[model samples]
Target: MIEAQGLTKRYGRKAAVSGLDFRVEPGRVTGFLGPNGAGKSTTMRMILGLDLPTSGTVTVNGRRYQGTVWPLHQIGALLDARAVHPGRSAYNHLHSLAAANGIPRSRVEAVLDQVGLTPVARKRAGGFSLGMAQRLGIAGALLGDPGILLFDEPVNGLDPDGILWIRTLMRSLAAEGRTVLVSSHLMSEMALTADHLLVIGQGRLLADTPLNELIARDAANRVEVRAVDHHRLADDLRTLGGDITLKPDGTLLVTGLDSASVGELAAARGHVLHQLRDVTSSLEDAYFRLTENSVVYRTPVPA
Candidate 1:
């Protein structure tokens, strides 16, 4: 398990992360989410001991990452897929990491094959495509078979097949009781992959909860209704404090009201209901609601 207590980091006059306290327990995938410039990269760097925190602490297991001997055997990370040497072959790169971490040379071949890079193991990393490079980087992370893994945008530049492969891989790893922390911007994928989430904005911990809870908390309660007398039903709902929106297809989108209440109201008003059901919000919807104010860079909507 990974834990942080009052973790903070600053750069000159700017604070990157402030008083972050959370635990990434084993046996599940924890998604690290935040908007751009929200200090996600900075926090991850501090967790890996790549940067010193201005105050407090973050530890892998019970110890600091920098103080651990044979660090790869305890925690493996893929923060940057392009951090490899351009001139070295994929096989050589893994071999070098294995040698330094006291991992067996045989393990290098195993991970290379595991990542499906055995066919192009001899190719220079500089020439590998983005997807291939991501695979190679994953191979290095698995070289030690650590119990804890951190993947930052592992699906970036991957094809659909590669994306599915990593998703399955992370889930299986968690099934084996290993700790997995994934950071990505793809909410659709995160909805399917993560069991829990750690959301931050402006370097402050905004949410640390289960996936379902986060969705339920931020997603607005909305109900979709289709009826013969859409106009009458909408007007009636509005009078009862329901926020209503009339769609182009003549459907009534009702908010601040539940499906049963809307149905009962329509029935009492003698309106013929065609369809009445709750509109489920996607992860994207909840994420937008949660991070609306946290967004640093906004694209102005066209008038």
Candidate 2:
């Protein structure tokens, strides 16, 4: 497990991260989400010991990452997919990492095959496409077969199939009781892959909650209803303190009331209900609502 208490980072009086307190537990995939410049990458860098925190502490399995004797065996990470030497072959790149960490040569071949890079294992990494480089980076991360893994934008530049493969791999790693933390801007994929979330805004912890809880808490409660007497039903609902919006398609988008309450009211009023269902919000909707104020770069919407 990874834990941070009052973790902070600053640069020339500019705070990158502040008082970040959260835990990434084993047996689950935790998504790290934030708007642009929200310090997600900084926090991940601190966890991997790449950058020193100005205050507080972050530890892996109760020990700082820098203190681990065999760091690769304790935790593996893919911060940049293209960090490998341009002159080295994919196999050679992973081979060097295994050598440094005292991992067996056979493990290099195993991970290469695991990441589906066996066919191009001997090809120069510099010549590989972004997708291929991503695969190689993943192979290196799994070289030590560590119990903890951190991936940053693992699906960037990947094809649909590659994206699905990595999604499945992350889930499988978590299922094996490994501590997995992933950072990505893909909300749809995160909704499908992550069991929990760590959301940050302005370098501060905005939320550390289960995936479902975040969606339910930040998303507006809405319901959809259709009935034979739509106008009358809408009027009645408004009288009962419901905020209603009549759609061009004749359905009523409702808030301030739930489906059950709407149904009971319709029944009591003798309105023949055709449809009544809760309108559940997507992860993207909830994410926007939660991070609206945290967005640092805002694009002007067309008026």
Candidate 3:
């Protein structure tokens, strides 16, 4: 439903986004991830026609956003929750946005209820909290009932319950065959919500694959073995064609072989094994490890 080819964005001499190439297919939720200042937000803004790319082109549903006759109905985006006028009531805010695109007033109310902002529909947005403003922004995006949805950190300031709600909502939207692209810096949250991920670093594409595949590709398939004869077991496993690293907590970290093979070797050596299990790497750990060297800024540690 969305395609970008050689998309590049530059400001003065610095390229905020450089030659990004990807496609967001319909019927699946594509999670966009990157470190701070990695051009994720800039890229999203370009897709929404908020920023013009320096080179290449991006299209939603096979047409540029600006070229679409009814652009709001083709793609809905929530780039910033604070885009609404704080002085206007929630209902009036949506009504004004809806009228801009010639959308009916009923859509405003429908979307308000859809995003669970009906209770405060008449309240001034200036008095609403960040989470409430996020909901209002979401309501505005859904006002047109657009087929393609782009959410940039929809859960940024939300509570745990709001986070869960957005996750479920994204999945359901994709299940209904609508194109959904949600971006976040939280790898843990993305792991739970996204079926596929488009990871970027240094304004470049790093990896784009299924969530499970991304994890499995970088997963440290090591096993933690604790046995009565820890030293002896480590030595024996080293001879049996596996690398062993000793931990300070009286355990051996075994790699290059599965736990079952490690177990058999321990049994052959007459060693009593107390614990034998695979230690798979978490998505968050893998993400940090991959992006550590690409981070734009780092805080200094004082001695």
Q: Looking at candidate 3, what is the lDDT of residue 147?
A: 92
Worst 10-residue stretch by lDDT in candidate 2? 214-223
lDDT of 1: 0.92
Q: Which ranges in model 2 have alpha carbons more than 4 Å from their true place?
A: 218-220, 225-252, 262-275
TM-score of each: 0.91, 0.88, 0.87
lDDT tens string, model 1, 253-276? 898988989989998999999999
Candidate 3 residue 167 C-alpha distance from true site, Å:
1.7
Decreasing lDDT order of the candidates: 2, 1, 3
TM-score-better candidate, 1 vs 2:
1
- Top candidate by TM-score: 1
Alpha carbon lDDT of each predicted model: 0.92, 0.93, 0.88
lDDT of 2 at 120: 92
Which candidate ranks first by lDDT, i.e. highest? 2
Residue 85 lDDT, candidate 2, scale 0-100:
95
Error of 1 at 8 (Å): 2.1
For residues 63-181, what per-residue lDDT tens digits would candidate 2 score against the true structure? 89985777899888999999999999999999889888899999999999999999999999999999999999999889899999999999998999999999999999999999999
| Best-first order by TM-score | 1, 2, 3
Distance (Å) between predicted and true CA of 209, model 1?
2.2
